[model samples]
Target: MDTNHNKGDKSFKIPGDWIEQSKQLKEKFSTLTDHDLKFEEGKEKEMLERIGNRLRKNREEVLNIIKEINLS
Candidate 1:
């Protein structure tokens, strides 16, 4: 069978779930409206911080996968 079917001839192919996660993260970050981010209000800033943490974690996972594939 074709174990590399998901990758095919592409140089890289991130797992499908990472793409979904990235989309969700983008949607979340996009919700921080200017009104919600007024100076000193902090709510929007805090929301962004939380999302940023999650994004970093997800990004690290994707990077690790990419590195592994490259090393092989």
Candidate 2:
């Protein structure tokens, strides 16, 4: 029986060193500033989709890493 409250949440609890890893991940993705990013003249939609996909993947990766640490 699982008694964890955050089990279903995509958000992971940061455990010691994993906290640092999460911070690094956030810093890495923070480079994509709206003002600094440019899309091709006709590729606005495609660019948005690509950014969304990357964000989702990155989030999952961070969560997984946190989970591993929590389990250990």
Candidate 3:
């Protein structure tokens, strides 16, 4: 379903509590939608691309944003 063909950000992995983290991201970044935050196995890069594109950021920024969110 992910149309991102960048083949980059291969080292990125979704957090264990990605569902919760995703909610936090959605709140922090209103432009992000459920579809953009959706996580499928082995699809981290694609999801990152969607998030980065929506937020007008790069892959690293997106990765950092996801890492900065706390699941607590």
Candidate 4:
């Protein structure tokens, strides 16, 4: 599946239920803000970058977090 985007972004895909996933992320990292999790359909790279910056994590780390959250 077309997972990564053109800029070599890791964890670019937001879960189908992002509202719930975003809630989970916020709970895990209380400092995360709505703006930090704001995702545009065609702007996954930007969103992941923002999230990685806010969480002090790499793209892969953010990907794993999202994967785990989706699994739960």
**Candidate 4 lDDT over residue span 22-71, tens digit each:** 99999999978999999788888788888999989988898888999999
Q: After superposition, how far is residue 35 of candidate 2 from its true place, in Å?
A: 16
Give each model a TM-score: 0.23, 0.29, 0.80, 0.82
TM-score of 2: 0.29
Clashing pairs in 2: none
Candidate 3 TM-score versus the reference: 0.80
Candidate 4 matches the true fold with a TM-score of: 0.82
Candidate 3: tens digits of C-alpha lDDT, residues 1-72: 888676663667676788888888988888899999998888877888899899999988877777779534
Off by over 4 Å in 4: 1-7
Task: After the best TM-score superposition of candidate 1, give how far the Cα of residue 55 lies from its true spot, in angstroms.
Answer: 0.6
lDDT of 1 by residue, 11-70 (tens): 333334544444443454564344322223324334334443544544345345334534
Per-residue lDDT over 1-72 for candidate 2, one digit per residue giving the tens place of the 0 to 100 score: 978886644332334563354445446677444432234555534544454565654545645544664555
- For lDDT, candidate 2 versus 3, the one ahead is 3
Model 3 poorest ten-residue lDDT run: 6-15
